[model samples]
Target: MDYLEYDDYTPGNETENINITTEVTFRGSKSSLSHVLVAFNIIILVVGLGGNSLVIWICGWKMKRTVTTTWYTSLAISDFLFCAFLPLEVFYMITSHWPFGLFLCKLTSSALFLNMYSNVFLLVLISADRCVMIYFPVWSHNHRTVRKALGGIALVWFLSALLTLPSLIFRQTTAHGLVTQCFTSYAGHSTHKAVVVTRFVCGFLIPFLVIVFCSSTLCVKLRRLTIKSSKPYKVMAALILSFFFCWVPYHSFVLLESDVKNHSLDLLQTGLKVGATLAAANSFVSPILYVFIGNDFKQVLKRSLTSRMEEAMAEDLRTIGLSRSKSKSVEMI
Candidate 1:
């Protein structure tokens, strides 16, 4: 669930001069923003976490025998985990204090960034899978094994973790009088700027570019298909739209932040703050828009959980209830 953002120690970053002159208000560093952000983020977090959790439970429980569902289930688990920690942001937004000390401050903030990276990485992987399957159908027919995709996804997670290592290296709690700010601690001022630049490129710019490229190409190719419409294409379209919806704001904010840095625009500070809060909300958007609403995600989720008990009586008839002796038995059966 942690989106994999770049590490904060990439070099040439303007960490020293990065401090705002009364731009960011906290309960000292982020206080006033917290009030609004806390309410919004907390609400989003509740919805996203709850929804994604259900998706994960269902996918893992009901579709455990399948491959794509397994990847999606893992994705849900990651995203939901991030949602679970959002209350911390909400709590800090209300009280404006990072009482958890340096360790937690760094870990929590870094975790959020990591989740961001993970989310994007997962999306990119999904897009790639779609493209590969379409372009090489015959090959995919032979090689598109659930086990193979799962292994690939596992590799994505590992690389995402590696890429986010910089966050853990740089995140820290900086207390200035009444406010305790959570931020990255690059080795040098230049390094901070480098970190930000790298983040803009690797996390936002590159991933966005890849998503757009892959999805667009896939869309064009799919459109040309003379074959009848299948359920998978619809799923592919939903996935792309979901990726676009959740991530646009976050990346846009990065660009806006770059532009707004030390500028004296009309509604400068307030605008930047508002934009940042919007960016944060991007973290929760996809879970609401995509995973919850797409295809039969809801039906699948319901079937995964309480459906078992309701249908337990009919267990003898058949697991799917469609026909007897269709699919083999599954799970704790």
Candidate 2:
């Protein structure tokens, strides 16, 4: 994505009538901090991959493989895929330039965000599910089958796919002899701004609001109950807090990037620089959090390694217990 600059726009000021295509510089820092950020980022990427993948494996094996696990599994997959791309970001940070071609630059940005949105979307769905179970009780029990949950997950994937389509269509690499940059060329004159605005609204702002509202509502509702299982809220709270913390500054930095002057950009740039580090760090923490909250992870990585391990073990013992008891009854008769 290309940053837009404004000749007449002032920093920290919102202008409703400003041109959307105005070219702004990304103006981040070039200090020892960049080195430190990248250094830690490598460690984060490694941990995030191991942690999230563990989530998928555990959910797949040790859990009963219910609707919730399916949904969480799908979300984990998205995060895992995104984690796969972190090395690129780490490299770009250290190298201070995108050596990858135009297609990759755009795909990398758009795809990772696709996963990001997918993560938030699934979280919203989970919160909504909890709210239904809390408020509607019987309805949720009758209607909350795995089939229905899977359908919703499918829709989320389809929508996320549609949202990320712009990057594939518009993202391209360009070189001005000495300098190389990754950017998108909008088809129409005004369409670029229109698209950017659309992306901000649909891809980010709308979902963010939905997640915030749904998760907060769920948090409030669950907090009222003194149950052991509702403890998932703690996980939800930490996840949401981490999620927003990582992305807020990135979004703010992007907004500032689109409009701010050099001076303003410089300040926000430092924030942006650190924000990326924070975001990458966020990825790693999620997996570790899963291990703490989801017993499935711990159990699956046990001696048995099947997604159906929990069900199989329960069924096996149930069958053996029933068979022996039946023989005893027959002998007594």
Candidate 3:
């Protein structure tokens, strides 16, 4: 997905005084960069589409339903859908043209944002669920059910879509000479600033904070339990670190874009492109991370897809089954 800055261009006699020395150099560098980015996107599309689709099938169809499966299934769906749209983006990037027109421009952009917001929030939910299960096992046993998880997933999807409305509303395709570009446009400077601020806060900062708090609290609780195996903690740390590593650069570039002066425009643009690529890479990285988290390295190397999924859902099955037995005993009392 391309993140574009829509700046108004005005032609006047003052244009004659503007320096054009770096124009040719920037153009050459940008062309090479674009090719590299397009190739990277192609790789991401192939790997992400295949990996996430496997996760969806395993979680949704092959495995028994549970809260963990439900959450993961949703995550897989989002990543798969985002990767599905990458072909169109790859084509646009390769040709430097937007042949798909306005509706698709809006649709793809909205879908990207939808995946981003939904994935982060779902992670927060997962972290919170883990924390609750560990700290308040009794309450978790009584209340954490597949039905409740499904309901929460539905709500997260709705909120993600709602947050993506601005992208759908403002994204447009404009043709300048031979090149057609897809970008987000706002009616005024204030509107643009508001959109950027909203994205930074709602899309990045708040969810990140929630993940950190939940993870830190969960870490302390897990330490108190004197658990011998550090595997689960390591997996949690990887997930948290991956999320920030993938997103922070993109958001930082976005914020920096607004403040950059004219002389730094080329550098800022290149940075933004790199940031966007890193962010998009998250779709593929996440599924791989989940697989690693589910299985030991040797198991991952040896297991078939079905067995891998079964292994992934093993803990969920045990947890749910244990909760049911506990609840039944409490009811009998």
Local distance difference test scores for all models: 0.61, 0.67, 0.73
Q: Note each model's CA RMSD in angstroms.
A: 9.2, 9.9, 12.6
TM-score of each: 0.75, 0.75, 0.80
Cα shift from native, residue 98, model 2 (Å)? 4.3
Model 3: runs farther than 4 Å from truth? 5-30, 176-179, 227-233, 296-333
Candidate 3 lDDT over 200-232, as tens digits, reads 898889988998999889878887797656765
Positional deviation of 106 in candidate 3, in angstroms? 0.3
lDDT of 1: 0.61
Query: Cα miss at 45, model 2 (Å)?
Result: 1.8
Residues 1-333, model 2: lDDT tens digits: 234433345645534323333321232336777667766877877887887887787777657778778877887788777778777766655543566886678777675558766877787888778778877889988888988888999999888888888767776665656656554555653555566566667766887788777767766776687666644666767777777787776666665554444446457557666655666566677777766775655566664556458789999999999999999999999
Best by TM-score: 3
Best by lDDT: 3
Off by over 4 Å in 2: 1-30, 96-99, 176-180, 184-196, 223-226, 299-333
TM-score for candidate 1, please give it.
0.75
- Roughly what TM-score does model 3 have, to 2 decimal places? 0.80
Give the clash total for candidate 2.
8
